[model samples]
Target: MNDFDIKMIKKLILKGQWLLSEHALDKLLERNLRIVDVLTSILNGEILEDYPDDPRGHSCLILGKKDNKYIHTVCGFQNKSLVIITSYIPELPKWIDERTRGGKYHE
Candidate 1:
């Protein structure tokens, strides 16, 4: 992913949108966004193509690193895809938790 993609990803994150397909998401980001972090954790290694099955369903995980900050990108299922961003895994971003309650999309 390039700088442009990063910006798009960040935009989507703020807007509470999750890309259903990783490839599609990448294409969208590549065209309009920029990388905010030079060495992001999300781009560190191979992105998990598949997610595990759960109550909330499976989701691919991507990590973004900015300075010492880490953003967790949880890309959920196709039918009901989700993105939960957090500086830390144990504690989710306050907004994310509030929005994700009851498994409903944030408004």
Candidate 2:
């Protein structure tokens, strides 16, 4: 939840020290998104939520913008590298808009 994790993630990403899990890769392909998009988003985005106590590991939801479009990325750190847990374009019902959540998704 703190800035350190996000900073570490950004650092790892900037240095090409990140990995995309199988699930994350699948999500990216399904959305027709490129690694560039994910990296760009992470680099330009801000952390909206943090999951420091996730059973899986510490992670966060980052909302980023590019060319007037929005993308959301879930990231975590492991094995001294940043892991892309998942990424997608936030959509209706769940998102009222790019900056607002329409529901309590974590709960």
Candidate 3:
């Protein structure tokens, strides 16, 4: 993501200007994740991937850690509102680390 996009996301986060989609909420519950986990992840996470051409507009994948677990959060923007598309913990054979994937990397 660009600096502008990151800035916008950070602003929304700081102002509590984001919301989770039903699907995202369901996933969170299924994974035993809490709202605070999402928020904390957003506040301190690192953007690992960017999707500027997403059909839903600009979005990015963030890598965060909570309770010693790596949480991957997919976030997008809708009408200037930060939308939580999905969130889950990274598993083996897919992720090498919280910030690095197992396959080839993309810039």
Candidate 4:
């Protein structure tokens, strides 16, 4: 993957405030070292994927982007994180943006 993609992936892994799958985490590990670097930076949190929008669960894939602002990923050795994207709340997606519209409360 390119630097930008790696960066975005890192942002998600470092900032995503949701639950991340161990399987996806494995895929992320295979991505690139730079991606691992970004993940190492935080040392906290993990990647989070689909939720309300994904009723069937199959619709849930890697990480769906609402506006392509920010993606999502997993972190932590145990893989513990939230389902809400905390890194780029305002500029990530409409769902996240609307959920965190107050910039204080989360949806």
Candidate 5:
């Protein structure tokens, strides 16, 4: 495992060098989340966990705030671009809280 620089990630996001994964898009749509929300969450967010060797690619879980609520955004760096792998509200058995993991299903 390795760490991704939050500054670098922020830069990538700011430059529009980012895109959503198919699954991320679906989740965003299903949850009624907009791209702006993701961007805001990332730009103003912090890295909660890093998945430097994610099979999908090198990605990390970010915890960010959007309108006073917390949202999780998983971003991956691939081909010099940031790929939003997935995102969701931190809740239930999967998450103990906004910044803590609880269950076995993490990602």
Candidate 6:
């Protein structure tokens, strides 16, 4: 999205100021994803979509890779901190590529 959002996300990662939502944590565990995997993905990923008008405030979808598999992370801002809304591996029948979904380019 904007430089400020990107900078804040990076800062959150560097300072360990982000937290996973309960639902997000559950999904990670259900999908056998590790916290480090999600973090690494975010640290090295690219923003795929932006939702500045999200009811929860500004947020974005990030696409990242881990172990050759692609991971999608939904990040949002809350109380001056970054929140991991959700994280999951991209699946077929929905995702067309690492940066696309349902025939639409997310980038």
Candidate 1 local lDDT, 3-76, one digit each (tens): 22344444554565544345534633654323334114444422423456545554454555545554445554
C-alpha RMSD for every candidate: 12.2, 2.3, 2.9, 12.7, 2.4, 2.9
lDDT of each: 0.40, 0.83, 0.79, 0.34, 0.85, 0.81
TM-score of each: 0.31, 0.87, 0.81, 0.24, 0.88, 0.84
Give a tens-digit lDDT track for model 6, residues 1-107: 33336656877898988888998999999999998999988888888888877787777988887778789999886676789999988876578667767544333
The global Cα lDDT (0 to 1) of model 2 is 0.83
| lDDT of residue 72 for candidate 3 | 90
Model 3 residue runs over 4 Å out of place are: 1-4, 103-107
- Candidate 2: the clashing residue pairs are none
- Per-residue error (Å), model 6, residue 76: 0.4
Q: Looking at model 4, how many pairs of residues clash?
A: 8
**Residue lDDT tens for model 5, 1-107:** 23588888899888988888899999999988888988998899998887766676677889999898899998876678888888899898988899777878664
Rank order (by lDDT, best first): 5, 2, 6, 3, 1, 4
Superposed by TM-score, candidate 6 places the C-alpha of residue 29 at a distance from the truth, in angstroms, of 1.1
Q: Per-residue lDDT tens digits of candidate 2, residues 21-79?
A: 99999998999988888889888888888888889977889988767779999888777
If the candidates were sorted by their TM-score against the true structure, best first, what order would they fall in? 5, 2, 6, 3, 1, 4
Where is model 5 poorest over a 10-residue stretch in terms of lDDT?
50-59
Off by over 4 Å in 6: 1-4, 103-107
| Residue pairs with clashing backbones, model 4 | 17-82, 18-81, 18-82, 18-83, 19-82, 46-75, 47-73, 47-74
Clash counts for the predictions, in order? 10, 0, 0, 8, 0, 0
